[model samples]
Target: MRKKSVIAALILATSILIPTHVSAATPKAGIACSKAGLTRTTATKKFTCRKSGKKLIWDKGVALPQATIAVPSPTPSVPTTNADLIYVAKDQRILRHLTASDGCANPNAATAHLQVLIGQNWINVKNINFGWAVTFNVCPPEQLGKKDSLAWVEVYMDPGTTYRWVYTGEVNISNRNAQGNGISGSTTVPLPRPVIDPHPVEGGYGITWENIASRVQDISAAAYTDAQATIARNARAPTAADNFTTYLSPGAQSIDPNIQDSITLLKRTFTLYAAFPHPSKVFFVGTTLDEKDQTYAKIDTLSPGNPFIKNSFDNMYGINPNLPAGSVFTNSKCNGSDALRNTFTWPDLKAAGAILTSFCPTDNPQIHVEAHHGAAHEYAHLIQIQIYNYHNLRAAQPCWMTEGEAEWAQTAVSPDFSSYLSLQHLHPYYLTTLGTDYSVPTNTVWSASELTDYFANANKIATCGATPQYALAYSAGAAAVEALVAIGGSEAPFALDQRMANGESLDQAFNAVFHIDWAKAVLILSDVVAQKMTHVNQSDALTYQTRP
Candidate 1:
């Protein structure tokens, strides 16, 4: 049998043995189903099933009215948006064991849950798209079949564009049998197309267009104990390869205990985090020695804020000379002809809103998953740079268009964008307020989805006329580009703008361009954008009338 099959068999064998401890044959209690009032229709009632022995019984669901369940109380650290209330139970899918719920274990299953938590939601629909971290109480390891089951749960919905119902999948109890142990699960579901409008209300649609696959995480407990000792030994040698290797070299020399455990805790906590539905590649960089090498660390001599080394190379080694120029890098040393030039272009940095830096254990296997998701955002930049170069139009491209395209492509490459497209809910203001100013300081409390909408709307404006205002230019221009792509397919007229800029022309660009029907494309793009906007406007009007 293949290694994967063998490993899976082992997992199944272990799970079967672990959960069978409960001798009772009664059905496990399952959760009750109720609409959260976040979606257009009620979800198939979800029940929790704990092993009662021979059968699984229905347990009382969390008792709260669908609408009342989401009633605003204390604000969460993360802003509460339309997406927060809507929980598409299917997206919570994962396959993980209880003890292996975190670190060096299965990351694909873990990050999948995280992606759901971080996802943006549509307006009116009560569906929630969460990302990264979700903590739940109850469910333990030792209790397994007796009273403990999986902390992670999965709810299956009907496969359709309308509000339909379907039976729930297996209750994913954690492989571990301890209370407060984490678990993860995932599944796919179809959402309805907009019946009312297409445009967004507060800003633009909070759409998810990216996912990650096949992540590797490795973490060590000992490495944390002698962090300083590890760093000291590695710093002396400073071999280029050490930059990448020291991360997991557990017994190299001295180690730090506290840091090591903390790293382990983080790994365990996030292991049950969901994975990105689609991810292209993952690269996790680290210091040469087990100890944190201050010389090449994210907090090196440069600035304390940005957690990246300046003269770093490819996460593996030096840059690939044959590759195209302008790739992102955490460290740069050799100045090859095709080095990861400077950081993102001025326009990209301007549009990024806020820059976030994260630290991870070099040995943590799941670290790569985060790297893939983080780096995937930059891949869109690669495309943006390439396409725009083809057009030779260099004035700061609209922030919305570039970012939106990047966001769109992240999902486009894997798992597919269909899920995000279906789940997104937009506001009308996104269209009417096209070319409006909405970007606030990154520190300011503003909605990420709303800002994206503004940027998207601005890009639409840029597509129609030259010198679209910076505020909303990118959003409008991108929409216009989408509109153009719809009409002409990928080979349409404006398609060459980037190529033309790159020194290609109407004829030459034709050969290199994609081919999509122009008429149908235009109709689809225009209709979609317009419809989204209409729905947003209606929702907004109602809010206005009800305001005291």
Candidate 2:
């Protein structure tokens, strides 16, 4: 007998007022319910309790549709106008309305149209129809006081195509001044060609080396022919004896017998590579000796007679004569016992020369191979520099080509040296480590796409240095040269150098020799390296032939 019971009784009275034809037992529509969230279903439809005004009642229900379907209406098309072509200044609000002074009041006024040259035809850009005078005011507010009327429009241009703004149309009475005078003319202003900066301030455009090569002016036919002739003249076969003279330092006579054997091996390596043209002389300076204090003294004693020693060592050590002779070996710049080679150009004497310095004692077999093959490696660099008549190999070519070719040269001279076997083993590890950020995995062989992306994004080796990245030039670089030789025959790498000496870029030389672009050659080289590293078995002696 509470208020809730009174409301329930009144709902039952309302149900009695329903028509007899409609089923009063089931929930039809507009029926009272006890509370919300209640559902009732019938044979034809389903119903849910919904709030109607302030009362909870069974409202309209959903019913399944018949088989008959209705078609949808077509969408309307929007017209493009001059407003769509107008350029909006950055950080400025869009101008919604144009006044009479904006120059649209004169419908027949002479206007300029922007057109771009496409296949010998000039096509209108964006249908931008507007008077040249009004362009100054419509573009930006600051253009009002400018002497010349100018405006900007957004349009994509195809490379190597020309574009211009054309002025046309007729003047009408509305465009005339109060004195009944009007200015009318038709002309065209050519837009300047766009310039592309190879080294942009903002990075990540992935511009290839070919992009930069294309901008350089090509060498003349006469110059190219002359370079080819020079290369052919220098392409002689190896001789039985050494063609260049060797000068041994005073300390070299007193070194261990094992070191002397390494020097003999270096001379044998030089004789093998003597087929290629090089400098006339080479000096052998042994930094290690029985007495350490005599190292700099021996170099100084040889300096006055030898121009290379005078210019390089005498100039460097003579600064402080009081410094101990052993200080030459202890200087942070000088390696402790590594073999090194340096090429010097004597401008005053009008000559060039090369020198090999061996500091290692070669106490063991591994050190002996290193000293022997290491000297061969440095001599190969001299050959490369002289072949191209270049001062530095890294300047004319990339570090990979420079160092890799040297590594290849050394192995070619001494196939049983075992240094290249270690390099072959290191190649895979270096590639995998360097390519980590680029999604190159270590467990599987790299695909062409993966290798391409890795090379594209990998840190470029620009110079020959001691860093791990620079070390890649020796291992992977040698593999790349092997691939090149396999593709273009034995002289392909040197042929590339010859062409580059004729003032052609690396991409141009690559195409001239291999009949392929540098990018494609790189893809093939990388794939070959990956395959050799992951699939092939390395041997102590490199069986790959350097010459046919």
Candidate 3:
């Protein structure tokens, strides 16, 4: 009886222990799990609790062939920081950063420096310093709205190493006063050959190996050249007058007895521009008649025998090696047109001349007026070229400004010649296709983008042939100038040119003279163009009859 009682007690203990061990729930696929990474083993399979599309659920069990041993995962490696990227933002601001997350967060103050290449040597940029502890640092703005080949950035990484980023491409800074945000051009990676423990020398940004004195000299020379140009510009007022002479070609007299009348008109045009700044000696030669069979012999006889004049005639009619490459005037004869030449002789004797052709007294009254108008236009170019030379300005002014100002100058000679009226008459027909149409009509409304593009491509248009597209510089360009005149007075164009000659860009000059931004000016001009287009009538078309 005692042995039977002990066996009953052992069976009861086993039943209580087995029920306690089986109390926990079994894991099944697609069922909610209490904890992630939890696993369980059954007789047939092993299941794991893992993330299944945002929910912690028991994963499908893996078949258990035998008892398995678990192994731990290897540790992940940390990523190193990438080299710094430097680029010019669309608005012409220079920016530097390590990565999207990592910026120029330097702990040291004023360690980030900006430098500019002034000839061949890099010199420290003056007046602006980068001291901010931010993701990216904005370098000092240089040559705003224009490409600058001479700018770069440097940052001190440590006492033993300094990272440098040099722009391999031209960088243009924003014309706006505010800093730019997005990159505009190619990004430059940090130099592979790091600057090692570079010592800051005078006038250089932590570049001990460079000849600091030579760099200083280059900067000084550049400043001196600018100063000289400024002095030359200031020496003559816009209203100052200069001397000029006129000569008529033999063909001019042979073609028409009333050629003297055209000569008189040419003199009048010269007199009109005499009040403005001009080259010291301007020689006006007229009438290379018979457009298809034109010859330089007649022009040679009529010219003042000045070597510069001869060279200009050669360059205009024949191929002169001295002529600038891609010059629009190269082998560009005045056979069927008029032109201003010898601008290359500026600031010396500064010999310049106007070659008038295709117009004679024998032509109809309207054609006669057009001929004189063309002469007046060429004379305006003489004044324009002299001003450019005085300042030693190298960049060609925007086509709109160049041609529009010339068109406006026609009225300066005679109110009978009105560019404003001519453009008004044509505006209605060409309003919808201003940029696309080859007529280059000035009467259409303008967008900010179109104006910007026109301004940007002014040089290219000036250098190309006189396609209808090139005429935009005349028509629309005249309208822009007329708008400028209406807002800023007649002296506005001259003042704008003067400002540009003094080293300010067109945008800068426009803002300074008009007290308005380019976009704002575009809006105002658009309204002006729209009003002219809207007011068009039969009488307005008649007004264009007087246009030269």
Candidate 4:
């Protein structure tokens, strides 16, 4: 099977083994259908939903209502506007879990873009500092055989973006009754005054912008963990305008722990980078693969006016010397990645947002899943990219610099991470490059050829007198960054990285941060590896295997 297919199958198989656990505040109690105050989605539709916070939801269609007090033609006037988005109620869609009752599974989160049909044009809505909550349907006793369910309604705005819904005060109906989804879900919005006049929607005469895909999340979602709370306390929380979803298979939700760990690790990394205030923040991570794929592809283009240009060689190690310049070359070095490029530009847009894995323990049976290691490593790339505006530029720091720093992030993101590496059996790939040494020590002298393998392109490595290059970009590469840290202190690598990202050449950055040329920096790291961190301690084999 294809790699993506295999992953999809793995997700399905794992989910089948895990069970769904629902946290319904009120299992049977519900509000009456008539009293739910669901605004009709259309003049003829039956299933309906509505916004609970505002007094008057906008009439279904593109045109919103704006009460403009008459003023001189050119004079500025304060105009009152109410355009709460509205949807239809679900009377019988319960069979498919389409209504607010679907909150039974997960009700506090959503992952989607707003699609508004204005007049005859379908517009993609962007830039909203808002989020949603659920509303309960209080079905009267006469609604036989129907169980109480909740539909997502109500929005909270202007709150800061937080895992917990606490920033903005209530702007919607309360659901203190356990029979409902929750007391009230909130959004943490740092709203920029909207460009309200930019895209005015004229009420549709006949067009439709109907049906909302509820982003209902679990009750515990947004409730900050102590770690996340600390981020808030420290004033280092992520502030990008984005939404995220970890789509678990039916069984994976209960059976897989690695996915959850990775998700946590991903979020934690976000906080760290936000503290740096990363430059290239993404738009969103959708609820489904398709959504992510599309978003990724859109974001991948460096700019609308000047799309990035790349080239793919036609071999396992497609390192053709004859390949043209002014384009990216791929030897399929799939391990190292970040928020932008990967080993290969994703051929499948549907698999867009994943920081994918080429190592499958089941296939190799030696490599293990280190969730935080991979997550943080990928995130570090993002930080690196922002520091450099890398996607727009052509030349990059050599593999040793890029991969080595990313590898360092694994150990730096969490203390527990190094411990995990310590227990992992060196995957065969690494065993080849590191030469049977187990522990990642600071002193290990890599040969001139090995350095070439890590820093040189495939064509150069193939010509260099080395065997099985093994992409020595991990341990060896990391050693490169660590060597910088050793000489200049912990902050040196990032300082250099920032300079490089800000249009300074590699030589300039090295000169600026370390008072040395790139040639000297390379040799210094090689010496550090040789003199310090050479042999691996025997204690790290088991950690990698059991980490997931």
Candidate 5:
């Protein structure tokens, strides 16, 4: 009975300890896997089994879903990272010129570009609107001031070698003012040895001798690296305000400094005249240089000796120019005087003349300023011709009006011009453009009456009414115009022209604008000049001060 009880107890205990065994979940025999590329040992055990003789290999770090595995397997214990995505080569440098999230030029959007480098080659990965730097610092080269944007960055690998190659790439610009506070992006550059040369001969940005020859007046290839270095040093682009100017009026001196600035000042003076109340359309394609004796550089536009060239220039400028076939000049003949601009169509005020270029000697930098003043005088003639043509009157009776206003125009251009005006210095001697063309041994001192007679005689009235006997006739006219400016104010020329443009006769216009008649205007001004000349403390000299 005890044995029977013990056997029952043992059986009951065994049943309670073992519990009910359940089969582990695994792929059933002949069951198909849901995934197409399903393989055994190579797959993850998360949901697939790694049994014997099954195809197998690890996919590095590729993730496999549990349900996609063919056979049931245990999940792997390897860890995975949660780091942020980084896609830049020059990550921080690029961020120095980009925005974090907001739109760069705009403020409410995001922009990003990633340039990738694969082995020895550079390839565009994500080109949103990112900018890069050729130099490590002062970096964003193109965005200086308002609307001043440079959208390219070029790299000169093996920069100092003869076989130079440049890797020019696009720069992304934004309105960050280069603050680039939260900007993030990258530019992957290729290996330097195999530099990608965009332009072969010059390598796109080489500072060779050819660049100086072809570029406009002051631009030089040697200045290229300096240009970038200057930007980096200044923290902002080099500007006149910062006093760190490069070729455009460089602050500190270099190989050549004044040439570009000289051109700039001349052009600025040109705009001042062009914007004068009676603005004339004078096409000065570029700055003019009056080089005398030194012809190291030739400007074909001004010294175009060929007839085809001259005729082409005439057509381009709306003028019927005459440097007659046999009369056309070169060398000393043409150098006798500045090419005189002649008028053919008074109505349209079209005129033409030779433009010259020069070195302007080491002694005088102001030669350019003086020549500009002279050009202004010529332009004034154009303005006056337009005025007279507007009134439907051919200045037949008193042609002195043209030279008179032009002389006055010189003073308005620059004080350098005033040296030629008798009224400016109240002196006995004055320099004139045409006067220098002569090699006369004697100085012809004109009495006040002679000056008066030059303008009074109607026949000697074209182009300052110049004749062997009365070369200074226009001096009286110049004085008269100056007197008009004195009494009526600086705007007298335009005001007088406007009156004539409104159909007023010359006499009517003079009376209305200057409150004086033509004869009296000249006679009175000349008389005043004579009285001043009598008491003037001045010398009479043939050696005058004019730009060579």
Candidate 6:
């Protein structure tokens, strides 16, 4: 989802909360000392400031003095490696700053003093977390040090672009020596390296606008071929991989191997990279289609390569364009194109047609059942059916259960079902059904708070909450299921199996597992729901929506 940057402490936005007093706000003649500063080796370079009540009082215009500390042998020779780019000695630390900018406040403002390493080996700068650049024979020996005493670079982007610069200033190296004597030993010297772009490339990634055009034809063709094959499988009896591939290739977009594996793909145009089979490929899936039959390209959920991708996908797929952009669509009914039509299980079309016409005369008077579902609803049905599969349909499950579960699962693939959260807009008939008699009881009704609590606790582990309910039901409904499972105590083992066997309602499955009658189970479920509601005020539900 959202790009985030972590600088030691979660330092967020720069406060404009500064005093607006005419003289007090004026910039000093020399170096400025802010709460944000660089880490230095010598203590003498430490920033000396005090808080006058709520305001910060500083030695204005005075360059906080500094000295340099040299590393021992193996002083980390100049990284001559040929990477796509090289950071000036100090650029390594600056790079760290850039990573933090992913979520930090106005990064440009935070890194006003920062500089980047440019061009060849510009010595006299500090470098950390080096990488190997094959062409130039340059690289860091390892990844970023989680916590290192040695100062690390922190890079920040210029508010609106990929261009990033470094933050350079002195830090306090002394332990607890508060007096000036304890700080006198530390020094602030010049950075050890320079930030340099080997290619001096304008855009960060080597790929250019021209490169994008060159690859567009191939990418589009590949997506088309893949979609066709997937649809062919859907028309017949498809395997899990086939189903998964279809989901991944929505909107007919091909994927990049590296991108597929990167957790960031969720934010990218791809539909289900993280949920897909392969973990390493840089995958790219097409977004929901537009009325014009085009796919929107979102780079990492937040990074929209082409801004119009949203409107186009939303219009064609009937998705809520205004919903939180990064949240996955869990209720979408349609697929990009008409792929489900081929997913008919029957082999002989004539025989199947007769069977369909005779059995579903009211639904298929013209024998065109496929068109009714279309791509959206067909995919929706598939999501619900896939969980249980035809093989598990022995027990006569209730229609409400089936419909609700299917409706829930549809949202997993496309979160549009959450539109139901707008309870006020619900049709009069639907609202009546949402009340206690048909829904959960007054004591156990799935309220927003209870749902939030269940999700908060359930996300603590994977195996503990494997039922589709945790994913599809969401909010209140999810909480009800969570409560049912908790009280019935059969949630883990019986959920999936029960749903498959007889299409059991979540409540029915719980009673079966726990060997309790439906009435008793409902009472226990109510108790659990009430308990969850008590702590609902303290739980954090949205955390899982955008973690990492």
TM-score of each: 0.26, 0.44, 0.45, 0.37, 0.36, 0.24
Please tell me which model should have the higher lDDT, number 4 or number 6.
4
The per-residue C-alpha lDDT of model 5 at residue 224 equals 22
Model 4: per-residue lDDT, tens digit, 299-393? 34522332211221122123332222222222234332211222212322221233332221123212234543565676566556545444311
Off by over 4 Å in 1: 1-295, 298-374, 387-393, 396-401, 414-418, 422-498, 503-528, 536-548
Task: Estimate, for each residue in 1-548, the C-alpha lDDT of model 5 and write its tens digit.
Answer: 99999999999987755422101223333333333334333244433322233522222233456675478689765322112332234332111111122112221132233333333333333333334212111121234212212122112111111111112222234332133522223222212221111111111333222232222112211222222222233344222222111111111122123445333433323333332323222332222122221221222443344343234334222243222122222222223222323223222333332222222233444544444445456555545544444222222224445555666555444432234333232332332222322222243343568556755663222222223322232444554554444444444555565554443445666776656686666555555444433333335221232221
lDDT of the candidates, in the order given: 0.29, 0.45, 0.44, 0.35, 0.35, 0.27
* Residue runs of model 6 more than 4 Å from their true location after superposition: 1-239, 246-285, 291-383, 386-473, 484-511, 531-548
Minimum summed lDDT over a 10-residue window in model 2 is located at: 93-102
Q: Could you give candidate 2's per-residue lDDT for residues 411-440 as a string of tens digits?
A: 554433233344332343332211111222
Question: What digit string (tens of lDDT, one per residue) describes model 1 on residues 1-548?
Answer: 69999999999997776534432233223422122221111243434444345544445434435543665687546412242354343423311111112221222242222223323322122322312211111222222223222122222223331221111223333432133333333222223211111111111111111100010000001111122222233344422122111132232112212224322222221221111111111122222322334434543433334432332233313332212122223223322211112122232232211112123334543333333333333443443443443112222233344544433332222222233232222321121112222332222122334434444444332132212234232233334333333322222322343443333322344344533333333333444344333333353422321110
The model with the greatest lDDT is 2
Stretches of candidate 5 exceeding 4 Å from the true structure = 1-281, 285-321, 324-367, 390-397, 415-447, 458-474, 497-505, 531-548
4 versus 6: better TM-score goes to? 4
**Residue 349 of model 5, lDDT score:** 39
Per-residue lDDT of candidate 6, residues 1-548 (tens digit) = 13345442244332333333322344442333344232222233333344445654443333456556676776555423233443343212122211111111222222222223233332122333321111100111122121111212323212222222222222222332223211112122212221111111121222222232222212212222222232333343322332222123332222122212212212211232112111111222323223223322232242233233243234223353322222233123432222111122322211110000001112222222222212222333333333333222211222223333333222222222222121111011111111111232234224444434443433222111222333323333333432322222211222433332332333444444545554444444334334433333333322211111
Scored by TM-score, the top model is 3
Ranking by lDDT: 2, 3, 4, 5, 1, 6
Q: Which residue pairs show collisions in model 2? A: none
Displacement of residue 49 (Cα, Å) in model 2 is 99
Error of 6 at 429 (Å): 15
Model 6 gets an lDDT of 0.27
